[model samples]
Target: MLRISAEDDRDVAQFQQLHEDAKKNGFGRIFRSTFLFEDMVKSILLCNSTWEKTLAKMVESGKLNLEEMERRDMTAEQVSEKLKKLTGFGAFVTATVLMCIGYYHLLPSDIETLRIFRETLETTAQSFYDRFFPFQSLAYCELSQLDYKSVSGCSHIKQLKAA
Candidate 1:
């Protein structure tokens, strides 16, 4: 049997706190793999593309033979090339898909994530990564929700507007 252990370190403690806080706020853990293909397509569509364009591309790509792509068992580079031929996906989008496929560590940094970091944390992406380290994506998800709630008045809209 495979065994795992964690030491009682500051990093571990911080991660536990973050996870608990997210759960307390009714934010369930995000398992991106459940909808891997769709997520990959959406991530690709989002690169240097408007929301409307992305939606349109999603509809268009939906008609393609995605299962065939899966059957080929291509390398990440080959998969990227094939996706580009099929959907005109850019390097960022290709990298995003590779990241999804467990080949990369970093999340695809995009304009929206950058905006969230700037508006919510008032800090650089590098600083955010340094603070969160391995849990950057999880931290981003939690903080992004908080940021949206703060700006959009998820509760007490009138009070927020008044202030």
Candidate 2:
């Protein structure tokens, strides 16, 4: 997730100025050194009980090729479609993979994330997406990281929960 791309770093740095909450929170890029395949395996393990055996078999048989995906520089949509065809991959897992691969435009919301946004933030997923646009996931992540009490005076996303 944390590739050392100066270009990406610059873009994310500029993104901080776009949202008031993001600017207030000093949001910045978080790098992860783990490979995308490893991230996928970790995400898969969370949802699928037979994840170990299934993932091993899939990779060994060349069904899920990380190299090819990287080489193609496939869009998040393309990657998502391929992952959705596999077992144990719903929107959450697929979105996790896409995010790990640097696709911050997509929001990866599980049921809890949905509940918190609805109950705590008083905002729907649509509203979050609408506010943040291409950087929705990044903004969502930063907002989620804030202290609930600290953000009480902010617009919308009230009663935020610490996550």
Candidate 3:
């Protein structure tokens, strides 16, 4: 889910430029943060639900008023509490907020502080996984010996090679 809190002022135009660059570089899906309440609610919906169910529920809800979230006086803790009151949310969202507690300490008291915290947790998770248990060529070597690329569904690796 998109956990946004206010922060100190910074270069918005630069952030937009970075966003555009990320989009061009195929990171758009990971960096999608617009001012739309629907998008934000959709982000919440997607927290634990399957993609189809989340989209369907958001479309069904039509509009979710989360603008109070951007209020200068609101705290992330308060916002998280209010969000839990909403109908569709569940424990997963609550857990996510708990996970975000460390970041909340530095949260801006104002919701319009002008800077977006683009945490790279997803990238960090992948890096951690790779560091601990990286992709091993031995697995691939055995698979290749068996000529089981088709059965094992290595289409992506094949595409990578062709490219």
Candidate 4:
């Protein structure tokens, strides 16, 4: 589903290449959920917590009736409202779940992710979104693989200094 189109410009090509290389190196594919409720809860746990903490929270939360959530066939708005009721589920977390559930237009632009974009790409979130748009998440995933030191020393920094 995440294929690189022949018509896509240089940015998409870069992302596609990075994603392919990562796959070859045995990086696991991004996680998605068949059950909406599970994804909703996972998104909540992902907020302001480590992956270990997310797992621990899920385990502590116990069994959920994913079938019921599916059966409800709730609208994105409804699901967002429900997520808001949970502790620690903020606007960004709610947006993340919505995005995970196939709303590609929304960027789950939290503080940390924004900081990474600023540091690495040297761009504002709105500008980054304007350029990358639907592929922003894919770009973020690829960029996340870079070492901080290497990124800091990247040629872009040299170009910026020259300018």
Distance from true location, Cα of 145 in model 1, Å: 47
Q: After superposition, how far is residue 15 of candidate 1 from its true place, in Å?
A: 18
Tell me, by lDDT, which candidate is best: 2
Clashing pairs in 4: none
When 3 and 4 are scored with lDDT, the better candidate is 4
Task: Residues 1-163, candidate 2: write the lDDT tens digits.
Answer: 4554775676577777677777788665655546667777787777654754445677778877886665447877888899888877888888887767767676788898777755644443446456678887887678668843455433434323322
Candidate 1: tens digits of C-alpha lDDT, residues 1-163: 1111232233344545767865467442233545456766577556646554343454456754444444446566676666566443565676676555443434566677667655544333435445677887887688677874653422334333343
Clashing residue pairs, backbone N/CA/C < 3 A, model 3: none
Report the C-alpha displacement of residue 95, candidate 1, in angstroms.
Answer: 0.9
Q: In candidate 3, what are the lDDT values of residues 20-117, reduced to their tens digit? A: 86546633122224543444455456554555433345435755334444443456667567656665445554433333332223322222222221
TM-score of 4: 0.40
TM values, all candidates: 0.35, 0.64, 0.31, 0.40
Deviation in angstroms for 62 in model 1? 9.6
Per-residue lDDT of model 4, residues 21-126, tens digit only: 6546744233567655567666766675555433335435654333443444676677667666656667788777665554433567788877886676555333
Candidates 2 and 3 compared: the better one by lDDT is 2
Off by over 4 Å in 3: 1-32, 47-65, 94-163
Give the CA lDDT, 0 to 100, for residue 81 in model 3.
71
lDDT of 2 at 161: 30
lDDT of 3: 0.42
